[model samples]
Target: MRSYKAKSVTSIQLPPRERRETVLTEAGHNVFNLAADDVFIDLLTDSGTGAMSDDQWAAVVRGDEAYAGSRSFKRFRETVADVMGFDRVVPTHQGRGAENVLFGALLDDGDVVLNNTHFDTTRAHVTNQGAIAADCPAETDLTTDTVGTFAGNFSTDRGWDAVEEHGQDAVSAVVLTITNNSAAGQPVSMANIRETAAFATEIDATFVIDACRFAENAQFIKQRDPEYADTPLSEIAREQLRPADAITMSGKKDALANIGGFTAVRDAALFEQCKQRAILYEGFPTYGGLAGRDLEAMATGLREAVQPPYVAERIEQVATLGDLLRDRDIPIVTPTGGHAVYIDAAALFPDIPADQYPGQRLVCELYREGGVRTVELGSFAFPGTNRPELVRLALPRRTYWHEHLEHIAETAARVRDRRDEYSGLEIVWEPPMEELRHFSAELEPVA
Candidate 1:
């Protein structure tokens, strides 16, 4: 049972089947393009979609809106330092903003950034700076039936090979995304983190962690890694960051806030450089691009995020949903993930080739069948990439309950039963940017 009660509620209505079908066609078959009011259960993303706690709301009211050196910024900085063990915290409007600031300052033309697997925006930001974004995922089978505790680990072997392939001097940074988002929200092991950090040191590259879901990742460590079974979430979180030279976070995820993120560093010189970049792109260093209230809420959320009860319940909820789908014989990535349940769209639609976008087809069918909105993270999201075709049902923190999850599972079962009726999707028009075309690309049923 939850330790808290709902203080407020929002009304949601499921649009009729005909209306949903029309909306899908009008939105170019892209869930990202769907209007909010037209959907029943919105699961397109967990970013900035979670509901805040009462404490966060109280902090928001006490926020100091000063232009620079605000009280809220100091509190936020202190909280981040306390929880993440970083002295310098520069806020941003969101996670991508932190990425922009960090990459803008650290990356140059012909540079390379390596990660376990770069989510859509992270890869885009690295490539946007004219740098090569390389993925070094651990050698593990990510098929639906393959189960593991820490499949999100980075392959040090692959990282070393990449460094050699593109001269060591060309490598600028090695990033590890905690609870690897692109790899079905799996958690990275502490042992792997230490090994990857050592590898980064050997290569003389900055060890950066994309820590959007840091707390959840830490909780996973406590549960899965026997060494940390007795450790507190806060200490685990600190240990997770201790190896990183710097971190870029999207506060939207673990921070439990609506908006705000930060790029934190241990080196004062590098911190100054990131601050200067923040000034140029975001607002002043203190406020970055967010309101003071956002900083206050983020601070409170950071504290709340690491508490044992909150993290355990949050992770368990996701696992519950995964179990629901699995009981129905749905092909889902196992042992489920921290924030979302990844459905193997390729397995679901074996006849639909990668070029036809099976993942996107599933996304469309789920919406049309049951008013549940989801996003594709396969060929459509990462064009030409030889990765699993997945549809992520990202659950927002504290926003859903058992019934909501059941509805989602029932919806998936309904669609799966009539899977033969669904076909593949073909992109009719896409943007010039090849990396992020899934966000706005227009598509249609492949006839």
Candidate 2:
């Protein structure tokens, strides 16, 4: 494999000269509350945090800024059709915006939205519409001690049963989030996707995909599925989307673009509804919450993201970090996810009680001790005890070389050394009742 180096230049100071106390005070108790200037290594999210290639920069310069039917939109649509086989495309500012439009278009007051794992924004959008956001996560998700090949799979039987349990009339859509983010970034099998689609079809339900990480999921399919071992990444992706009636995407993750997303569907009526909602809420069809330059950049980045070398490199980078953690006998979700390395907080800190939120504590500690930023996917991300306490180190696409991963791994070793001394966290301030508390929840160390 060829080694890729970042061509961009920006100097950053290393570890803060001050002690941990000073840095902790600057960071507050919430990772989200911390400013980017204070953090040295950011692992907080893969969303809109990636580096763009030279080709993408050139495309951005060539964008045509037309009010309607812009050339940039045309290029973006063609790329989507080639990658996903969707007949119609509606652009959105980001993934959540796409979800809001589609869920509003399909979901009713009492409708049900089902997914393998509905990540934060998706859950907020679904529930905001007065619809039920239910998860039919695979049985493997509950087995937190072990890992599996497809832990992200939505059980076909469970999904059907959920529909039966909720009544078919109440079901709005059977959704699958490719590379289930909330479930430790696990990949869904092509077989499962096809089967789930078939089951949804049999029950007269719409099959939608939250395909934010479609490229990474496709790479996993190629490597894990013997039948697709020789298949190209684009074809693997095309087949993956074939099972879905529509797809909602955050171009930031897979496309290697900073900001862009779209909703694609084969249903003309549904697309029209999305269009109306989009224009009303977002902007015109041709430039929906994105500049012509963003559209052009997304078009270019999407094509590059699926290249054999790029896909291989992206997955390998994540595995490299996960492997380093495993080498130290650290607890992590084995088989390593495509986009991030998830540290099992429950295993890492058995002394720290779950109610105090060990996952959130680790997130804060990683930032305070090592100047690395990460997010908690456990009780902090989802307000429930059923989910495993996980701290996600999400790697940005085409950003951060192996040296950066080494820095993170070394930091993890440092944190592990003092794991026993690590205390818990308590929420000092939060809304009386908020949609997602993690975004704004204030915290303090429990002495």
Candidate 1's residue-wise lDDT over 1-447, tens digit each?
A: 987789989999899999999989999999889989998999999999999999999999999999999999999999999999999989999999999999998999999999999999999999999999999999988879766889999999899899889999999999999989999999999999999999999999999999999999999999989999998889999999899999999999999999999999988988999999999999999999999999999999999999999999999999999999999988999988999999999999998989999999999999998899999999889976798899999999999889999999999999899988877889899999999999999999989
Q: What TM-score number comes out for model 2?
A: 0.97
Model 1: which ten-residue window has the lowest total lDDT?
140-149
Prediction 1 TM-score vs. true: 0.99
Each prediction's whole-model lDDT (CA): 0.94, 0.86
Assess every candidate by TM-score: 0.99, 0.97
lDDT score at residue 223, model 1, on the 0-100 scale: 92
Which 10 consecutive positions of candidate 2 have the poorest summed lDDT? 12-21
Clashing pairs in 2: none
Candidate 2 per-residue lDDT over residues 32-90, each given as its tens digit:
87767777889999999988989999999999999899999999999888877886999
